[model samples]
Target chain A: MKWYQKHRETIVQTACLLFIVLFAYAGLTKLLEGHLFYDSIRNSPILGGKAMASLASWALPLSELAVALLLIWKKTRLIGLYGAAVLMLLFTGYTLAIVFFAPYRPCSCGGVISLLSWEQHLVLNAILLLLALMAIWSSLKNKGIPWKKTPQGR
Target chain B: MKNLKLILAMLAFIFAIGLSFAFMGDTGSGAWINYNGVPTELELDPCQGNGNDCKVVFEDDPNQTEYTVYTDDTLSQTRKSNNPEPYIIP
Candidate 1:
């Protein structure tokens, strides 16, 4: 077997699990200490003291959990990867914006990653996004076709 | 999806944690007080009327063991409440 086909399942599985941990921890922290997350967002130059603060608060954790759930299923796994990449892209963009523009940026990130500086956070998000993209490409290569064309098997 | 229950479990977990924080309210007890839900300390001059009149008051302080270690796991630094509101030193 070729290198990718030999290790395709492992690679995809590892990617999914990594994202599961990432999303779960980040989402759980926001939920556990929601007030801080909410306040931090509210203090942002983009979102601060706005009516949308409450919406972002609920939507963020909920979306993270949703993407994580999608990743757990084989049929929906690709969709989950896409979801994760999109979320990470948004987060990376937000971090970059804050680093460049915001005069008083607040760290709203949860989990141990909160210990990282904003620049480090951007790099971390970028790494995750690249991993997710690699997973998507490898999965497509393993199947020999797009995911939708594959037979549904248990 | 083979594992539908796992999704439900995660949702339940999220709800449980969120509800716990919500029910606990914004502030915490002990030596520090939560300012607008954010833990903060009053850096006042405990002798002058300009701002500080009282020192760090604790529930049980016979030895005056100043508690400096805070329960701050947040990304932002500890917020300090000044006397004049937005104390800008030029």
Candidate 2:
């Protein structure tokens, strides 16, 4: 128990590790189904049209890769956490649109995870976002940084 | 704390930019069709499937060319045409 308490940071690190792994898997899957993802994005009201959708199709995968890389590096872990959280939020919004508005079901996020329904995908994103937020909060709090610190520290 | 907040804000901005670009590039739907004498190829809508089979019928001449391709499967149907004008399966 004492040993576990002493290595509590490891638990936080593990949470981050899990998030990175999940995103990396999802990111790679998206990259593989790049064309289908591009089609969905192009059809989305938020994503406007084909030309811009193509650009986004290219960027999203790279961004996911960047987030994974950042999380693995001690110097960039916080940045990665923030990036992952924001990406999840965007994905949540996109999933909501499909659940509420879109008439057709998009391709299953392929690769190792297989196919998932829109609602299931949304839930997954939400859970990941929550985990990421918790990890980021704990990391900052443990670093002796008070949540409500004054502009000029006490 | 300040740095954390700043990083979070920056991430939010990046996401917004990404989502904006995605929205700007949206294309509703599209398809392609290639009818060459024997086997016809079609780019179908993802949802238009019957169990494991995919159905494609010509919009202009439905009776002339009717096809059903299995999922992840191809269809090969021959049509007699001496001077063939590439048929477009709407």
Candidate 3:
């Protein structure tokens, strides 16, 4: 128990390192193949067609880069984690819908990450969400709560 | 100081990951097919090809050439030939 507690910091650090690495890689790939990424989103039924997809294409990569940067910053780590968690949750839902309902399989994410089956994509997002949660928890534990409850308890 | 160090380390890690991804490029594992002969049926995309009709050319040079792909308005795609003999299609 003592040893585990002592090594917890290291473990958390390693996990954060891995999470940052994975997201950065994914983000950069989307950035490079911006057009293709947009096309996938545009094709998605969840987006309700091309216009929304185009908007996502522009928004997603920038959001990803911002989240990854925040996760790496001590000051903004928790916020970044929450943001990433929400994004991953959305992605997981979308991928699962495609797997179960979509008539055709669109091109899998390109560049470094190739065409992954919907199931595989879901699993990847789940793992990322878990990692983000872990990092957020660790950050909160290390730093005291940022805000105090109101005297009247709101 | 410790927090700063941690942040720096995380940034370095992320940047490293991004660099690795950029280097990997396209893995070419998609549903691309290599046709051996003139394709009997070719799906043409107006946006990608030269208008509706396009011609692809293969050129050969005496010196061993590096692998490079070239595309122009007149030519949809071009590939360098391995053999010295030049073949042109009217």
Candidate 4:
């Protein structure tokens, strides 16, 4: 058997774990530094309006945590993968817009990730997006695992 | 074993959370400043000394725009000298 096919389940599980770690860390930090996160959104060129920034500040961290929770269980893993891909796409799009069109780019990411410049953020988001897509594809191909519980609930 | 991998993942998650807490700080905290009539975003660290000592670092190029920020108790009272050293973005 091919190496990837032989280890497909392990690979997919690892990808899920990575997503969980990333989202949980991101969500926690954003919540911890709520004022700074809100300020970043307020100063954002795309969503600079007060109301929009206010709404996004709360929505973003909650959504990230929700995605991480979804990825924790076998039944919700696919949905979580899709959620992660969508979030990554939005992040990548925002970074691309800022790099190409914004008046200036600011490092809004908290913690160690804030060290990455906008260009680096674009590359990292793109790579993560690809990883999410690949994991979803691999997961779909491996359909031997049962989705429903047996009568005995084993 | 599957359980061992799960345990390792949980441990990594815990480590990540701890690291996040350790490194968390005000990264993008700043106010918009009118530098020589140009609206510039500068990261102004809290001034511990008399307000004149606040080093205002330019968001894009810190070295080029390194200048002292003088502000009264409020940000609205902040002022910069006319024709201050022009910052060249590299």
The estimated TM-scores of all candidates read: 0.62, 0.62, 0.63, 0.69
**Tens-digit per-residue lDDT, A10-80, candidate 3:** 66667656656766776777777675566556544445455676677778777877777766766676787
Q: Write the per-residue lDDT of candidate 3 for residues B54-83, one digit (tens) a residue.
A: 222222334423222233332235533222
Task: Looking at model 3 chain B, report the run of 10 residues with the lowest lDDT sum.
Answer: B42-51
Error of 4 at B73 (Å): 12
Across A1-154, the per-residue lDDT of candidate 2 in tens digits comes to 6775576567557766665666665566567657656755654444546577778888888888788768766678888989988988887887787678764444443443335676888888788888888777767766866757678856
Candidate 1 interface RMSD value: 9.8
Off by over 4 Å in 2: A1-8, A44-48, A149-154, B1-34, B38-45, B48-90
- iRMS per model in Å: 9.8, 12.4, 10.9, 8.5
Error of 2 at B15 (Å): 27
In model 3, which runs have C-alpha deviations exceeding 4 angstroms? A1-4, A146-154, B1-4, B7-90
Q: Which regions in candidate 4 have their CA more than 4 angstroms from the true location?
A: A144-154, B26-90
Clashes of each: 2, 10, 0, 0
> Candidate 4, what DockQ?
0.20
DockQ of each: 0.07, 0.06, 0.13, 0.20
Question: What tens digits encode model 4's per-residue C-alpha lDDT throughout A1-154?
Answer: 5999999989999998898889889888888877667756765655565687778889999999888878877778889999999999999999999889875454345677877888898999999999998888888778763444557755
What value does DockQ give for candidate 3? 0.13
TM-score of chain B of 3: 0.28
Error at A124, model 1, angstroms: 0.2
